[model samples]
Structures are given as structure tokens and as C-alpha cells.
Target: MIELENLSYTYGGGELLSDVSLRLQPGSFHFLTGPSGAGKTTILKLCYGALLPTTGRLSVFKQDIARLDRDQLALMRRRIGVVHQDCQFLDHMTLAENVALPLTVSGQIDTAQREDLSELLSWVGLGTRLDSHPPELSGGERQRAALARAVILSPDVVLADEPTGNVDWEMSQRLLRLLVELNKMGKTVLIATHDMSLIRAAKSQVQARVLRISQRQVQLAGADL
Candidate 1:
């Protein structure tokens, strides 16, 4: 659903990404691995239309990203859910309200769809925490809450960065299971993480492809993992 051709991004006289080219097929799951400053997150931004490339081309869902205007980009983004490394939440708002923000902003909220909202929170293991504020949540709780919010719109694709970074092993596994479930439901999933152990754990449970960003270049990881 996403393709990049000879894409590059430069900032402050240094190249963050260079000649990166790849195609993410619909219904595929990918894990992006890289050291700090290797440009994994930058690449993610390009895919989601958050940052335009300094050079070359990027296409999302068949639309040329470079040519899309603000409204067009917003429309494309609505079809893709993104979970950031930091769970960006309004500390004053309840968890349910946070998860419902996408719908609210899109003018797509359905008051009659209360059951659906509750079911999503429950799916991410956050049902009881729905009334709680962001500050009250544990690290894992916050991550899951973020995931719940991302998928509440039933997006066609999900892009997650360091999704299990702060969670314990068990909680990480739980979060991974939820992501796996989403993949089973046919969502294209791309995750950026530094955790090799998490990638290994995921291998046995799903058909996930691994991509490593090293030396400013992107390549498919080997079976040597």
C-alpha cells in the first residue's frame, strides 16, 4: 500500500535517509529496525505524509505523496493509523475521549456507536481504564491505550514506532498479540523498533518481514535473525 522510489531526506547538511526504495504490499506486516539516528522514524514520517522527502518520490495507497495538498494528505492519513513512540495524549481528558479524538476531528463520530468504542477499548485491554486520565496510566497501559486509539477508526494501515519500548516482557507480548490480531483482520502493519528480541518473538506468530535501516540505507533483513 506504500512505495518509495529513490527517496532521500536531508536535514541540517546531513542525510537522514538515502536512496531508500521499497514497496509495502497490502495486508503485509513489516518491522523496521535501526540504531538511534538511523532514520527509521523519518522514513515512517515520509510514508504517512507527515514529512515530505527532500528528494525522490513516495506514494501511499497509490497516491503520489509529494503532490497531495493538505486536505488530500488528511484524507489519506485517515486511512492509516499511527502510534508514536510517545503516547501523545491530553492529560486532562479521559482515555475514552482520547481514543475517540480521531472520529471527533474527522466529524465521523457516531453517538449510536458507543458499543463499538467500548469494544475497542476492551480489545486493547483498556476497558476499565477508559475513565482514567493519561497521567494515571502505567507505561504499558499508556501504550495499549495509544494502540486502541490508533485503530478505533478501523484504518486500513497501522504504523507504530517503538510500540513496546517501555513495557515489561509479558506486557510486550500482550501488545504484540493485539497487533497480530489486527494483522489477521487484514490491516497493513509497519512497526519501527530497536528490540531484536521482540522481533524474534513475533517471527513464530506471524508472517512479518524485517527491514533494517543501517548506514542511511534500507535493506531487507536476513534470516540470520
Candidate 2:
């Protein structure tokens, strides 16, 4: 549902990404891998309209990002969920309130949504931690809570950046399985990570396309991965 054609992003007089083209189809799963500073996060930002391309075209759900107005862009973003590398939560809010922020902002919070919120937290294994504050959560718990919040709207696409970076292997696998389950439910999934083992582990359970960024270009990773 997201496509980038010959896209390039420049920052501070240098190009971070150059002539990159990729499409995320419905129900597709993709892993974006590269060295640090290779613009993996930039690609994710471009996909979700957080940053516009310096050159070329980016379309989300068939609408050109450059042509969209501020309100239109805001509306379009609701259909795409993002799990940032740093899972930031309001320290003053309860986990439930934090996860339910989107619904509250959209004026969609109600009894049924509250029920769904509980189920979502439970799905992320945070059902019993509803009243806990962000500072009380561990790294893995924070990541899972972030995922729960990202998908709380049941968005059509989910983009995650280094989601398992701070967790242990077991917790990483747990997060991977949660993401895999989301893919099975037909949500488009794109993850940018440096963890090769995690990508290898996902191969058996999901058909994933691994894309590598090298020398300012995007290429499909070789079988060695």
C-alpha cells in the first residue's frame, strides 16, 4: 500500500538515500537491514509521510504525499502505524491511557474501544500492567507496549525501527512472533533492524523480503543472509 519511486532524501547538503524504489503490498512482510547511518529509519519515515522525499515520488495508499494538505496527511497517517526505535511514553500516564491515546485523540474512545484496548494490551502481554507507569516497565515491556499502541488503531500498515534492539533473545523472539501474528492478520509489516539472527529466525515462519541499503542504494539481500 506504500510505494517509493526513485526516491532520494538529502540532509545537510548530503544525500542519505538515493534513487531508492520499493513497494509494500498488502499483507507483505519486509525487513530493512543496513549498517548504522545507512538511512533505514529515513526510509521508514518516508513511507509513513513523516518526511517527504527530497526528490522523486512517494505514495501512501495511492495518494501522492507531496500533493496532500496538512489535514489530509494527518488523516492518511492514521492508516499507518509506526513503532519507533525509542519507545517513548508519557511518564505521567498509565500504560492503558498511553496505549489509548490515539483513540482519545481521534474522538473514537468508547466502551467498545475500551474493551478492545484491554484485549490489545493482553495481546501484547500487558493486560495486568494496565495501571503501571512507563518508568516501571522493562525494555521488552516497553517495546511490546509500543507495539500495542502502534496497532491500537488497527492500521493497515506497521513500520518498526530496531524493535528488538534493547531486548534479550527470548524477548526478541516473543516480539517477532507478535509481529508475525500481525502479518498473518493481513497487516503490511516493515521492520528496520541490524539483527540478522532475528531475520533468519523469521524466514521459516513467514515469507519475508530482506532489503539491504548499501552505498546509498536499496538492494535485495543475497541468500547469504
lDDT of 1 by residue, 105-213 (tens): 8998877766777888999888787789999999999999999989988899999999998899999999999998999999999999999999999988899999999
Clashing pairs in 1: none
Q: Could you tell me the TM-score of candidate 2?
A: 0.97
lDDT of 2 by residue, 1-225 (tens): 899999999999999999999998999999999999999999999988889999999999999999999889888888888898789899999999999987888888887666777889999999899899999999999999999999988999999999999999999999999999999999999999999999999988899999999999999998633
| TM-score list, all predictions | 0.97, 0.97
lDDT of 2 at 174: 96
- How many pairs of residues collide in each model? 0, 0
